[model samples]
Target chain A: MGKVLMKGNEVLAEAAVHADCRYYFGYPITPQSELVAYMARRLPEVGGLFLQAESEIAAINMVYGAASTGVRVMTSSSSPGFSLKQEGISYLVGSELPAVIVNIVRGGPGLGNIQPAQSDYFQVTKGGGHGDYHIPVLAPSTLQEIVDLTMDAFDIADKYRSPVIIMGDGMLGQMMEPVEFKEKVESKQFDKSWATTGTRGDGGPKIITSLELDADSLEKRNTLLQKKFAEMKEQEVRYETYCTEDADYIIVAYGTVARIAMNAINKARETGLKIGLIRPISLWPFPEKPFEETRKRVKGYISVEMSAGQMIEDVRLAVNGHAPVDFYGRTGGVVPTQEEIYEKIITVAGGLKYEHENGI
Target chain B: MLQEIIIAGFGGQGVMSMGQLIAYAGMIEEKNVSWLPSYGPEQRGGTANCAVVVSDQQVGSPLVSNPSAVIVLNNPSFDKFEPKVRPGGLLISNSSLVARKSEREDIKVIDIRATDLANELGNSRITNMILLGAFIEYSKFLSENSIIESLKKVLSEDKYHLIDINKRALRKGAELVAVF
Candidate 1:
């Protein structure tokens, strides 16, 4: 297949369809509206269902219902819209339903304008919907990675029987880039034995509910869920590191900000700063291995973000006092410029001697 | 090499499509390309802009903080983005809409009367095409054939009839830059 220029939202929708996600329930929201719009146009052609529900709340419950029927299902929304879906997400988690939810993040504490921001990192990777559990989330920076991860979200969802979140932002959702959809690996296949598919005439009864009256049984279930989460954390960690082999300083970022950091890293490298970037692809799994490995060697870590400071905490958690973790951030939709980030890098490494840092 | 560009104008002035065409053309030529629009409440009215990156290698960031070239179809965009052009970059403004020269002395500026030229060509809608053609010619970093090929991919079939006029506008643009 040849590469075609496509917007991030549309490509993500197509990748979902390619992953055999036959049902989509979503309400329109800025930035990610194109995903729902594309599904409305493309899903029916592939014999899939596209439903525009009354509200974000309605849409996520619809996803829960469809996913319980053993069908691949999804829902997408931007920041304000996504907040309304939180209750439904928690319910899906409690039920262990395999579903893909997309949050094309926009600026916000409260309808904080319709611009791109990564403020939802904590809400998404941590528990947004009142739960003691965390969900696996993929934050893809580029359109091509969006394709790979959107498709992977389904497999990961089904494999773990948990909702997978694709954490994108308006910058990624609205950007157009050259992408070639990969030939799917046959969705990896699933039995879905616990599905609520219609009962055969004489088949035994089955129930699909997250409500458990007994405290003991619920605790047992929670323990099993914890085990599965542990497995996912060990098996599904994904991340990318650039120029980190022999670095004196490293930058930690994800999604759109990570790409901006890369441009800054390149400029900083030109003027003799031993800098690198660690971009986490899977936000929940968090990819701590790189941080653990690089901690003893690097002088400090710069955590850059579009929010006031959400992901920086994760970087700190991973670094664990091994090095100084500095933060640079912008909130409410203002993107950081490369020059400013480059200047920040120079500031971080200004007093350190380059030759001694390299141990020459 | 990477060409980081910003194309800006009012909503009806084809700013978004101009950015898309550049991205599509870059893809057709087998180069890495990205198009990022300036999206906010302003998109509901007033000015619109998009950043385009066409590079020999994968683009690190689609957001162009400083552009190698800028195409402003209205006075406001010219007023806004002219100062952000990289020192040795290029500026192509719609002289028909904007009445001032660039305030910067470090960069090259091309004052193409794209709106007037398109009107002379019997299609005011082709004003953006005229500007795109001039950018390609003046930059000489990309070719006209690549853009003509991209139109077929980007435009709907119903609009295919306008390809001839668009081609002419492009040619007229290229011709303008040749003698300037």
Candidate 2:
């Protein structure tokens, strides 16, 4: 198909449609409202369902109901809206229903501002809901990547029979770029025989419930979920490395921050600094393997983000004391510039020599 | 090659559309393009801006800090972004609205009477098209034909009638800049 310039949120909505996702339920929220608006206009054209729930809570529940019917379903919201849907998300996970939840994140501790932010990193990757469960989180850096990952999110959600989160910031949601909607992604289809799609002609009525009053049954369920999570960690760690072959310093970032870090890395390299970047595409399965491999060659690591420092904790854990990890970030809707990131890298690289000389 | 531009103006001045046009034209020319608008509560009646990046390679950041070029339509926008233009960059200002001229010695500043030209074309809203015309002429980032084609795509079918006036504004702006 020919390339069409589209906003990030609109492209994601289109990608979901192209991926055969028919059921969409969402509440209006800034940064992500366009996704819902696009779905509202386009889904009906394909004889698909588009619903705008009264609230984020109601919307996520609709996703749960639709997903249980063996239909490709999704719900989108911003940071606060995502928080409202956390309970529903947990229920979806516990019930083992496959659904795609998109969080086009805006700044927040609570109604902070309506601007792009990566502050929801912890909320997304560490299970925002109250329960022992994990959702595969995909963080896309570019508009095209958002389209590709939105399609992949559905397949991944269906593959594991779990809820998948597409974590993007307001920047990713609003920016417009050229995109080509290719053919639907071909993947192994999940067996929906277990789905609660009514008992007419089926062997028995499928029960889709997250409630387990028995302790032993609940423990077993937890064990099975943990096993699936471990499998995902082994199988689904997506990341990208730039100019790390002979680099002494590596900056780790994700989503929009990763793109800015790339520009900083390029600028630093021009000044003879051996700087590289590690961008985590799959934020949940945090691409720890790359850090393990690069720890030997790299001097230190810098974690840059739009938040104060959320992903830096993961970076430090991944580096495992092999290298000193520093962080540079902006909080409350402030985006860091490449020049600021470049300066931070230079300062961090300078400190590395001091630490070596002190030997303590 | 990468061309990073910032288009700034009042809310209803079509600043966002101007940025979108450049980005769409870049796409038609087979280049990677990203257009990011300054979105928030301030988007209503306040100073609005958008960053447009056209590159042969994938654009890293949609936000342009020190842009290679800046198009300012009003006084506040000109004041805010004039100093942010990179050295040896281009600054296209609407002289009819922004009374002050950019004092930057390093960058090339071209002041076009975009609003006045659009008014002469019988539509004041096409002032953005006039500024876009001057930008294309000064930068040569995209062809005039490509921009006209992009306008057809960007404008809705109902607004197709305004295309002729917009094209005229674009040409007049280009010709005005050519005289200098």
Candidate 3:
């Protein structure tokens, strides 16, 4: 494959076009501002529309509006901005619209920091927007995955008839990498069955609304969505395991933090610590199978992240108390160093006896 | 084993391009590779950095923390990253941009005025190309022929004519450094 150097933001924009997304509505936010800038330059060239909405709220609603017509549509924003769009996101999820949302996260409980931070882990995976619904979240650590997964996310969203989110930290958005675009997939077979296109066949007028009067019917719809989510766990869960079979300790992380953790794992191996990494590419599915397998062999586990320790909860749940799990992080946009992780691994090795008590 | 590196500098100095060429050379040598950069805010008006990982096996991480080597094009970058290099590693700094030297004597330092050399050669834009020359000369990271052959694949079509000048720049830097 020929590799062309491209920024992650630009690549995602290109991926959007490749996915046949004809409408994009977004506002400028740190780390992800370039996605909009890229779409502004590219959308017109591909006979698409790029709208700079007034706010994240307006942008997401615009996505809602475009998605109603069953056209591929997308929007992207950073963490705090993403918070503002939650109301609209919940609506999209409830209404079951096929749209792509990108969260190139910056640090924040509220406007934290802009440098790369994975603090939005709980926010993205646990339905940060609102309601009891889930948006399929894909976490890409590299620029190429940022492009490829974005293409996949569009299809996944369309297949499930729901909103899909490509969630990542600032590092993924800001980094440029060599990426080769897939030969454009022509998704000409549009399903107009539920779309708000002009009425056809036996219908006088079709309505698409989240408001249901019957509780049982609503419960059934929600149950169906839950089943779809279960299917996602079966069909879409993805992760990469490095040296877990021989690992004494497995460092679990996602997005940029996972990339750094791999380097630390390599360094630790030199010092005779058999540390490997469990990088979750699909953050929501959580990749329970691999973690469950790794827990059988590894002495202990460490949750490495850019946040305080969000994904550790999920890691603990996946491992099911089979082994001990610990946490290490640098918050407020600071990333953990290889040295820091090495120290933690050494500590875990030194205190291996503590594994039975609290998982060193 | 794969070694990842981040080379940072001001725009127009070809830092990102230099990193790309190194990563591309690794690909040409049949090694798995990735070249990544901080482009949006960092590449616009301030400093720019690209992370390049070259590996014999599948690359798990594309970001570099303790790189085997670092190519610093300006003072801010040198001051920022010099402390982060692994012991006994290589740090190539642009002498024109820095007034201070590396603190660690164990880490080999090659001081080349790549900016000045590129200016003399017609465009300061190729300073990164000149530094890329030093990087190859000192490290033996890739064969000279391999680099020359891969330049066209990395550079844009309009900029392809400058390949000869860059090769010359690489050779000049190699001739100056006795890293071998």
Candidate 4:
């Protein structure tokens, strides 16, 4: 694969085409609007369907309709629009549908700035839509990963028969990077046996619904879904580790903040901090194994994120009280620089204990 | 490795399209690449920027602060980014955008009237292509043949004959900057 520069949003759109994604339904949203624009122009060239639905709700439902046919389908939105898609996402999960949903997050508790923000951390990881279901989430920091992960999302969704989200912030979506679209893998088609397509002579049309009125049957399906999710946790944890072997501080972060932490670790290495970074490439499965390993040697851990502190809880859970856990962050679309992270490292390592003062 | 760059300008000036072309060249040369634009609210009314990075190493941080090189199409961008260029980097400024004299002596500054050249060529939209031409020539990471091949690949499908003009724009920019 050769280098071609593309915006993160545009790359997702192009990769979707290359992945043989047949249907795309999305509304215009900041930081992710380019994705829809790219799909609008390119989908027709590939003989695919691209629809700008009336609303985010309609868009996600459109994706639901398309995914039911067992074809590659996708929808993307920014923070607020993504919020609107949650209901559909829950439905997608309940139905065990395979679809790729993208959340190019922006600053917000509600309708925040258009700039980048990871505030949707809990919303995305804790199941933003509803119910007790978990969605497979991939957090990409760079543009290359955006393309790679979009294609991977489709694969993971199908493998688990669930909705997979490539959760990126505005910065990741808006930034451009040189990405080589390698010879695309052959689009793996499903058996259509379980798809809601009209049945053959053996049975009538298959009904695809999230609702299971039968209590026993719903439990059985939930058990199956839970089993699939458990399998994903074992098989689908993705992370990147930098200079942790002899490090005293292990900084844990994911998505965009993780990139900055890596840079901070590099800078701190020169100053003899012996800092390392554990970046969760896959946020939901949450990459617990590495943190469990690093907890023994590392003196303390700080979970850095753009949001107030969402993934920090997962880090503490992963470490299981083995090491001192702390949290430091900036919200409302402010990206913490390497210097800020370095300062936090010093603060955490300097015996400043992180008591659970704020419950959230 | 991936090198990403953001090329920004107003909508009609072809800044965004040129970004796509440069990225395409990079792809033809077999490097991992992505092209992102400032869309929605930010891009609706005002300056537009496209980030482009071409690199031989796996791209880690895609947000380019102090870019390797800057091709400024207007004064606001020049004022905004002139000081940010790393030492010994090229600052390709469209003379129309940057009328102010450069204060830095260490950096290479090429003043090209890309819009004027495009107007002279009977199409103002080719300025971005011209700038891309200069970028390719100065950078040398991508060759003319590869760029042309990529151009043909992007343009041939549309049966558009205007690629010859874009090729001319690319060559002129390359020729103007070769001696510098």
Range of the 10 consecutive residues with the lowest summed lDDT in candidate 2 chain B: B171-180
Candidate models: Cα lDDT each: 0.90, 0.90, 0.82, 0.81
> Candidate 3 has which clashing residue pairs, if any?
none
Every candidate's DockQ is 0.86, 0.88, 0.38, 0.33
Q: Which scores better on TM-score, 2 or 3?
A: 2
The candidate, 2 or 4, that scores higher on DockQ is: 2
- Stronger candidate by DockQ (1 vs 3): 1
Candidate 4 lDDT over residue span A1-360, tens digit each: 666656678888888887778789999988889899999999998899899999999999998898888988999999999999999999999988899999999989788878888998888889997788888889988776777888888888888788998889987887666677888656776566788777677887787899988999989988988898889889999999988899898888888788768766776788777888888999889998888788988877888988888998898889887887778898988778666887777766654544543322
Docking class of 1: high
Write the candidate numbers in order of decreasing DockQ: 2, 1, 3, 4
User: What's the number of clashes in each of the models?
Assistant: 0, 0, 0, 42
Model 4 docking grade: acceptable
TM-score for chain B of each model, two decimals = 0.96, 0.97, 0.92, 0.88
Candidate 3: fraction of native contacts reproduced:
0.42
Instruction: Give the interface RMSD of each candidate.
Output: 0.8, 0.6, 3.2, 3.6
Better of 2 and 3 by DockQ: 2
Q: Model 2, A125-209: lDDT tens per residue?
A: 8999999988899999988888889888999998999999999999999999898887654655778887787788748668999
Could you give the candidate ranking by lDDT, starting with the highest? 1, 2, 3, 4
